[model samples]
Target: MNFYNIVRVSVVAALLGTSCLPAAAVSPPPARTSAVTNEDERLLALFRDDQRREQAIDPLGMLYRTGKSDPALLRQVFTDNPVRALNKSVKLSLSALKKIDRAKLSPERQISYDVFLYDKTEEAFWLRPDMLALTQVTPLDHFGGLHIQFPSLMAKGSAVSYDNVADYEDALAVDRAFPFVLDNAVVRFRQGLDSGVVTSRLTTANMIAQIDGLLAQPIEDSPFYSPVRDFPDTVPMSERTRLQKAYFAAIRDEIYPAYRRLRAFLNDEYLPAAREQVGILGMKGGPGLYRHLIEQQTTLPLEPEAIYQLGLSEVARIQREMDVVRKEMGYGEGDLRSFFDTMRSDPKFHPKTKEELANGFSAVGHRVDELVPLFFNHVPRTKLLIQPYPAYREKYEAGGSYNQGAPDGSRPGIFFYNTYDLPSRFLTGIDTLYLHEGAPGHHFQISLAQENTALPDFQRFGGNNAYVEGWALYAETLGYEMGFYKDPMQHWGTLDDEMLRAMRLVVDTGIHFKGWTRDQAIDYMLSNSGMGRSDATAEVERYIAWPGQALGYKIGALTIQRLRKKAETELGPKFDIRAFHDQVLMSGALPLPILEAKIDRWIASQKG
Candidate 1:
């Protein structure tokens, strides 16, 4: 759900045995595109300028966001005033866009125009008084904030380059900037407090836990210190010593102190004020905020009550399927609650060691690779790497999430499997988990977009959650076709994952709209699904921290699935699986409505 944990190191190191250039350089540059028309050229120039600002605000985004087009960009750190600059950028982009006459432009330019205008408009919507009053004050959550993500970015062997003296120097600048990011975050939290907009007490505690973990570590062991742990041998010894000393100073003095202060701010100031209630509606502008988020995330006009009803239906439907999984085993099979308890407590269902759990993910990836040809022809050039979630991040994160690689296949796509709480982690779901997060899911969808230079940068890099997570959720169903769910146990896993998303719709809406308390939300999820208490609690907290986001997966997936059904019915014999997949993925991510329109157009064409 947190898109920040993505953008991995390039693939050159793993694939070729040695580095030819910095990983960024290995990714093929964005195709040399000239304007199709004078208007398009002008618009593209504007888009390019916008892209640079996009690159500036997001340091991790530079690779995929700009296709690593500017090496000088790599040398510069993240912008000083990101939130402010983003607001200004939206205003400027919108203003510039208004001067361009859409009627006069080529059809291609019109498409670009529509997408940008919609995107900028969506961004500007957040700047409205009701939205800003609710959102801008709470800059960081246990989930969506920079605090959890920044450490991972600067971690060794992650996205941030630590290959050379210049890389280290540039990274140091980014490292130094952390204090500002943290301090500004504090100011925002203070603003939220003043405006009667604060996050849940649970979220505040989790954030404090993360900060405390960081502070307790020695500077050398800190994730921030990871880059300097072992510098490239190419650097001079004297330089290495100096860099090491400087890194220690940066971590110990700058980074550590910032986290300490941030922790203090949360414990001493923020937590006492953090609302005991977990819903967005519990805040000053509750109803408006929840509505905006639903529209923004689901890319639909559906209301919370509607989504809540949809979730209940989905939960029931998934439960019936799970029932079949239970019946397939053919036993005394107690009531649904007891069945869920049986699944949870069964020793054979959970992995013993953390290594076994990780290996289970790899095995799933390998099995999925064998079945790919049955689904479609094209596959991502990127190899999928299965790794455990970094210890610091696992507590706050979901069971598994994917990080995309460079479009040119310079980086391997990483699937961070949560190996924390090994005993609580279920083995039955590992196959479905890998199928969703690894090769055929995010790896294929995200990589194919980035790899395709034929599309514009915005479509390639930009995404709507409904399309993005919808596609991933849709990917989970492919296991049914791939012969994975043939194993009754693995089949149960897929259903379990589906139930989690389905429950999210019910629970998320319940928390924010139906006035469900955090405990009540957690209980609802646990009562309905085979999810462990820790997993359920983390999930409930996630919905609380990032409301409406969890809906994207189920809402998007269902839409895509419905479109596919419509296509299959309309096209009849002409519904080529490969073509259908290409149509879905080729244009990259789209808003659900745009995606439906495009798919319908494709279906109509195929009908002939």
Candidate 2:
């Protein structure tokens, strides 16, 4: 989820299990004369049942926070028989979904029903035997590898709670299963080989590098040991010593051995068989697979060519805007490419050191914090923290990202900027980056949604790619209205980030659906924007690793922008920015079409 997770959410979750529903587990709703109200309680209870079942399958996800959960202290991450679970879970959920009478539901209930149906339908499409053949085999990739994610989970003061002795024991239990989880990935990879389903040699090489990086640290010096180095005084001395010994043993005996096994298999076998081709379309049943992935990510039935063209137009439009700023800076008359080259090479645009970059982002964050009230009526209670990406993941990650905090506000939301290559990190774009990854973007949207208790559990904690990233991208545009991008360079900085999203639309789709090579994507990006070769390469590889994902940011941002224009036009002077924003944010991460419908309803009501 780290890199591949950026703005995208899957419509089709690979839910699998062969269990029949227990309809009577939940009681029916209170009596209602209307058809909508009559079924709301009964159906919602069933919905809750299904959600809990899904959560139960993902115990590690459930225990991601620092403390207690419904099924507390469980350590295993992957669901049981995950590959086979897809068919079984989808068939059952889809069957259950079909039984619900959507026509009987009220407007609000109807939205819930439709959202559920959308997810189930997409899941049904992918779980079909042919498509599943393409997906089930390819269990791990460079971007979302557990090989990279698990250690972070085990690292001290992280997600897995270390508040109590039981928590410590739970950590051990989870650690014991780490080897099985890695071995399961191996099992899936072997299965993929039999079916001619293999990942790119490029991604495989990255995974190998990742595995080696994890192994490079000595057992005592490992991140997994960081959490235990200082136990709370509450933990008894003898028990603390026991945990210390057990952790060392787990790393030495269990965790390391599993990684070594995976590393050996990857280098010796997987690499040799890994495909030279990058896109998923080249694989067996890849056309259908790629199409479904696009649909699942974008929540629209858009063709790849249409999206590619949209990218080109957006890129051109943003470039024109950039030209205005360039001219203002007294460089517009000169060659556009040379100006871009200067921006790329100019040391003045970049931070001299990591601390300077961090402090710059923090300063921008402080300025934005004072400006939040001017734009929005609602601000999230959750705090935002700016930090650099960890040493291990910085190589694979983008320039910046955000991870949502606990809904309870127990954990502060973190905005991680990549400090991997310090010199290439630009100071001009820091304001835009902070806005996108921090307040009024991810922090505002994500925190507001998670904090809204009126929404259903899925809506609160769950998401869609369009509304989430779209809203964040849209938030950047608000910087101009809020007067933060007053500097010609700062305004261009926003445009610079906007151009990258536009480029993603072109490059991501081109690489995946149109058979554009990695270098083509990189070259196009370098030519169009101020991105250095390293940044271009990382972005292209990311698009390759996760197809159709980059399309979401621009596609989503445009949709929100269009909706705002419509609302302002229809409501005239009566349109309230506060209410309009609330209308968008209060319902959590709606699918784009659903979001549009809700905005239409809000507009009509405001007009009345």
Candidate 3:
């Protein structure tokens, strides 16, 4: 999953009751000339201007991407207010984009034009007043809520700089804004309460637990205080004392107090008012909102019922494959549930310690790196680190997640493995998980995009759930050709992971659209796969917190898989897997339709 997306995914999504915008032409355009060159330059210049203006308003976002933020802009905290500015920016950009004739540009420029238009038009829809009503009121959740991301952003391993005295003070300036962000969230929660559109009770409880964990940490151990605990050699000795004091003051006076206020509000006011039903379908504008999120997240015009049905079909097919794998593992003619039971109950399938888990993942990464050249022509130079989730955040996190590194390769991209409840975590999915979240998955897809200076900023940094997560899920299939899944247990692990994604399609749509209860979702996951109760519960809660997101993994992987099959069939033996991967990834993430178009164009070119 994209690190930056988690915090904002709950608050923003596609506009309800709207069809997708018509795509820009993807076929080869006329030959380039002085006129076309001028248009391309003008169009690119407009994109750059929009990015700069956006960065000006969102200094933290700018800092995350570029590792630099203006001191004057550091005080601007992230909030819902930017949606309005983004709406206006999209309108102006689209107007300017329409004036350029897409057919006059070269094919390369045409792809950029299509992606840019799709992105802005999609934003225009979501930023509408009606759409914002469904999102803005319910601001945070346990999964990707700002409460979780803020600390993670401030932690040592994250992407920002802490090189000198000025850097320390710039962080302080940003740290001061935490309280206001929390206050604004409370205001939004109150709005949700007034309108009877609050978050789910389960999610509210999860957020409360998460906040309580944060508040329980001592002042010195707080992630916000981490920066000053260890001073760099560049800082003068006299300044170190003051910096340490200021950092502690920020955490004590500003940060912890804000967290306590949020905790109290959630415990006292919001939790009671929060809905008992986990699904959004029970809320006032829920049905429309779920539809909007489904479209927004998957980048497809799929009805929830359609997704639910597709999920059912996928689950049955995967279970059949699981049955075959079960027989291969020396279990004779037993039901799939029995095999699942053994996998879950057998202590041998789990990690002995967190270090053991970390070592296992590191080994997988090393092996994958050795074979990287066999499939991918482009390998990211950005370092990938494997570490367990920090104590404060692990209980609520997923099995694993990837944080992007600096484009300049200063900080390494990290894949956080959840070692919470160590005995409950399985060793079965270790290699597949490593492939999905580490090398050639998020690390590859994200690092490659950002490292390529030749692409436009949007193509390099901007992304959608369908392409980003889908590419990662697709990356998991690469394990087969690489021979990682040769062991029957390992293959079962891959199937189990695949089953989780397939079940997400059913369960996510089931909860939000069909009103499946939280327990109901958990029971379904446990019955279908070897997932333990703890992992199953966490996955269900995640879907409850962020509906329609899990749907993208299976849907996206299927799309990429289908496109690859089409390319292979058409190109015959001439097809190069490396080139196919390059075509899919070289332009960064694209909407599924745009990606399909690009692949079709590549297929045609190869045929000639």
Off by over 4 Å in 1: 2-39, 53-60, 63-85, 98-110
TM-score of 2: 0.92
Per-model root-mean-square deviation over C-alphas: 5.7, 4.0, 4.1
lDDT of 2 by residue, 137-186 (tens): 66666765567766775777455668779888877777777687677678
In terms of lDDT, the best-performing candidate is 3
Q: Name the regions of candidate 2 deviating beyond 4 angstroms.
A: 1-36, 65-89
Pitting candidate 1 against candidate 3, the one with the higher lDDT is 3
Scored by CA lDDT, what does every candidate get? 0.74, 0.73, 0.80
Write candidate 3's Cα lDDT for 75-154 as tens digits. Answer: 32335455666667778899889888887776778888998998888778777887667777776788877777777776
Question: Which residue pairs show backbone clashes in model 2?
Answer: 16-85, 16-89, 17-89, 156-227
Q: Give the winner by TM-score: 2 or 3.
A: 3
Best-to-worst TM-score order:
3, 2, 1
Instruction: Residues 273-346, candidate 1: write the lDDT tens digits.
Output: 89888888887787777887888878899899998998999899988888877888663458777988887788
C-alpha lDDT (0 to 100) for residue 410 of candidate 1: 68
lDDT of 3: 0.80
